[model samples]
Target: MVRALVVGATRGLGASLTRQYASKASSTVFATTRSSVPKDFPENVKWLSGVDLQKPKVGDDLAGQLKGEKPLDLVIITAGRFTTEDFNDKGPNWDEEVTMYTTSSIAPVFLVHALFHAGLLSKGSKVVLVSSESGSITLRHESEGGGNYAHHASKAALNMVGRLLSLDLKDAGVVVSIIHPGFMRSDMTKGVGFDKFWDDGGAVTTDDAASSLVEWTEKLDISKTGEYWAPRGPGDIGTAEATLGKGLSTPLKLPWRWLLRKAISVILLRDTALVWSLLRFRTRTAIYDKTLFVKCGLPLAVPADQDAGDDAQADDPDGHATGDDETLAMG
Candidate 1:
């Protein structure tokens, strides 16, 4: 039998996920809420009330509640708080930013640590951190402009936390998935004045998003752990076309690796002596490993061998200095 826990399960995607898991035969579902249990919440689903993610002791409270239960097969943290911000007179509210960060990023670390220490998360356990496309710097484009700093940055921090947790738990056979659950038509969105974009933004019902997430979770494994994904694809990502280009596919994976590549390219471009040393040592077996070049910072196509003649060719590819070689030599 599978045991699943859905944090922040009073409403929206969390509630839907809890109900979905509870509906499955031979599956036990647990849910956490900051307030008292809702009247119509699924009878089969166990509830942990007064579980506020903003509080420092939230993790300990959860661990205490599920102390002796079977190890959870799945743990989904969906507690999130978003507040709009801008450079106008209203500006960014300090309280809102702190709350957003605490709920979305800081709390999950403690919650996962508590679970791991309590033996609630064992081998083969799947931990899903619900992030947002707003977390993606690549996805942010001029089209959307700027605002909601706290909401966006908080999710970004959550993504980093998820990645670190994955590395820490990899040896334990735990899979941590960071995901941007699709934009949804819920009170959370409505509260943030995003309802205007609901029609144009391709926002779906929370239940629909939950269904896609549940299906995706069922298929998730160690091979793709620590990756950020959008189970409903780029349909709702407004900047997908402007930022990532068109002709995209479903289960849209965020391009974090692209950022790493760009960073490496910047480093190689900035460090002239490093590139020069690499070129000089190209012939040496110890230094000229093509795999190492690929992994490190060589974004350009590398020739098989750079003999004296090839070096001459590279230095003056068009039979001219091109200034690049002169700059490299000066370094």
Candidate 2:
């Protein structure tokens, strides 16, 4: 059976993915955690301990766990933390701050490197980095309040690392990609506006988000390596084409099917609008023509038209001045 490793799989999206893969995919899942896992987790899931991904030996421990099992299939790095306060709120300078960001940004790349070094992701394997738009340099112009320095920086660093790894792993047949999970209603963002979030279609349930993300990842072509994805759906990428090309570190190429579909959709929409406009215009013209003819005292043109005139006349046949029979017939 296929095998997959999900780093940071204790809660939220990771936990949901654990459930999803266990229920849906026929694979032995290794869910990584720093401490304990809930008792209610699925039976097929193996909760591995001490997954300090930022440090060494993480890949080794993972490799050892899967040594006698089925071939390694996929690796998803979803381990992350968010601190709204300063970098060193609880502890002293840079160590805590550095570790937090490094785990998110730097460590995953090294983990992939370690995996390849150990021949785990030899070929036909995939790696996904659960990143955030908060790390995007393109979004810096739009950021407000900017206090989560370590979190933001770490994510940005993670973006860079994911891109580089995508390039490095391209020839190895390992597809590397990054995904933004949006503002999910999880322990990570407790007491945040849940109602407004769903109203705006931004906050997604962990199950919904995981299912969609896995579907997107599974649908990725060899051409989509190194692309940035928003779990909220498509069209939010800053430079999708450019990023897709470089991030995978392969020759720059576009998904021609995507371009073709977009062009066709645009054409079909234009045609549909034009057809509707023409039909509406014709309907309005017909209505105006009939109204004007009736007001000008011209003979009714259709059976329904004649009936309307006859009905009006029956209501007040003599109310309207009876003109000559020939003129009234012509009208």
Candidate 3:
């Protein structure tokens, strides 16, 4: 009787995740794509339209559906775009960066907002944001080969957005987690040379990613909200025993009364962006001041970190970001 909704269910990792849930027989899956649903999709799957990741309707449509149907047990955001270069800097192809960020990062957060607004996810509903370690600031420092800025920043933004959602929904017992799927062979990485990941060789399969995610998700405890995880480990990532006093344990200390206050703030409020800006500013200020060497009381701004608030505002002067596929032939 579990119900799941998957955005971008027509291809790649999204399709793989949808198949796993639909085939389980215990789930009623709603699969969405901008164009057509696959002919081979399972019988339990319902196909819907108007869920393009780049548009506001993506969240609105899914929220309407979830409000009308049974409450969603799990919602997965898998719509994404990738590029070898940061399209913004890679001139003549900047649309690629816009597309990547809109699909992979911005849209997923909006999807969560819609669900919250519609009251579609009951207490304890689970949400998954498919992120990548390529988005990890921790991992980027260790990358031997430099590049992939657009894809990397988009995923990192996705992670931060997940954290933001967790802050809003944690009190409702809703669990949100960001998952890092290891390198896989897919359209996103097409034409990229990797002899070891050749079709004939030992490459990670989409099915493997889906199965691993489900296995870990199934075993997750209620207390493990707002955590990032990989499929490579042994013990559960969200448990006190696993982390032994890390970030995952912080939420457990928040009083239940605080969650009540948050739920009220969410329901009675319309200033979502204002709330987000303030919270992000607070978090960034705390982290930057503590981590970076401050000179003249101002944190040193790195060239690569070029003022996101300014750039995002400048890039979308009209206040609406467009999708990469907007100009593509959907037919």
Candidate 4:
């Protein structure tokens, strides 16, 4: 049997992936929930309770459940919490801050350590840790200014854990991956009051996110170990366009192809404006040359008068003649 475990499989991506994995033939899926067992667990899928990742012993608890079993084919840790922070709270609230890191970042280190020591993950097993792009230091831009200090930093630390885990597990032929499951519409996001960003942030349903992740995980091997991926691609990632450049990283063709075309049109319009300005400048120069010849009596028909005008200018060498010349040019 292709045995797979979805850690923290209570709701959202974890729950959806549990259902997705069970849909496959010849697969027995195991999932974990903290306490509540939604009455709708999939048939043939086992649920493990008391698996809070914050506690290091939780891994040992999980190992006890799957003890004596074949090494797991896939292990995914998806249990995490996000906490909002205030920059000016007068003082930092250590409890919530610590809980955020413990839940999202620190626990995965020992949890995986426990499982590895317990022999729950065998050679060729795939270990997937659900990390977010929020963890991506590269993806951070000025658009998302602010605090969620632990929430963001924990994921970054988790990414580092994944990288280290990949190195440690490589000799055993185990593959590890850290991933951004796309912007998901879930309780974690909603609870943190980010629901207002749901639509604009390109947030997707957990089902869609799970489908992409399962498909990607199914094909994962050592070649992709320690790499981060967005199974849904860049469609829902708000920073992708700004950071990776428009259209280049998205799942579909750029939604506003016209915007690029409009940009080109503006450039062409600018060039045309420049050409028109240059033409007007040259035309004015030619007109001024013609007018000066006439006004200064330098035209072929007035060359004799030009000498008289020059003589007239010599007569008022002081200033009157120069003023007259200026008046003639203006006229």
Which segments of model 4 are wrong by more than 4 Å? 89-92, 250-331
**Please, what are the lDDT tens digits per residue for candidate 3 over residues 5-117?**
88888887788988998888778888887876568878878988667887767788777765667678888887777767632565334787888899888888888888877
lDDT of 4: 0.74
| Model 1 bad stretches (over 4 Å) | 260-331
Q: Estimate each model's TM-score.
A: 0.82, 0.64, 0.66, 0.73
Best by TM-score: 1
Give the per-residue lDDT digits (tens) of candidate 4, residues 1-331: 5799998887888989999899887898989878877678677788888888767687688888878878889998998887688687733557877887888778888877878888888788999999887877656668988778888888888887887899899999899988888888999899988899999888999999998888788888888787777777887777777755665542322121223333334554567666456445544542222232233332123322233434343434432233233222210
What are the per-model C-alpha RMSD values against the true structure? 8.4, 20.7, 15.5, 21.3
Question: Where's the lowest-lDDT run of ten residues in candidate 1?
Answer: 322-331
Q: Least lDDT summed over 10 consecutive residues: which range in candidate 4?
A: 250-259
Of 1 and 3, the candidate ahead on lDDT is 1
In candidate 2, stretches whose alpha carbon ends up further than 4 angstroms from where it belongs are 86-93, 191-201, 234-331
Displacement of the residue 72 alpha carbon in candidate 1, Å: 0.2
lDDT of 1 by residue, 57-108 (tens): 9889999999888899999999888778898867999999999999999999
Error of 1 at 88 (Å): 1.1
The number of residue pairs in model 4 that clash at the backbone is: 0
User: Which structure is stronger by TM-score: 3 or 4?
Assistant: 4
lDDT of 2 by residue, 109-134 (tens): 66787777777786778888898766
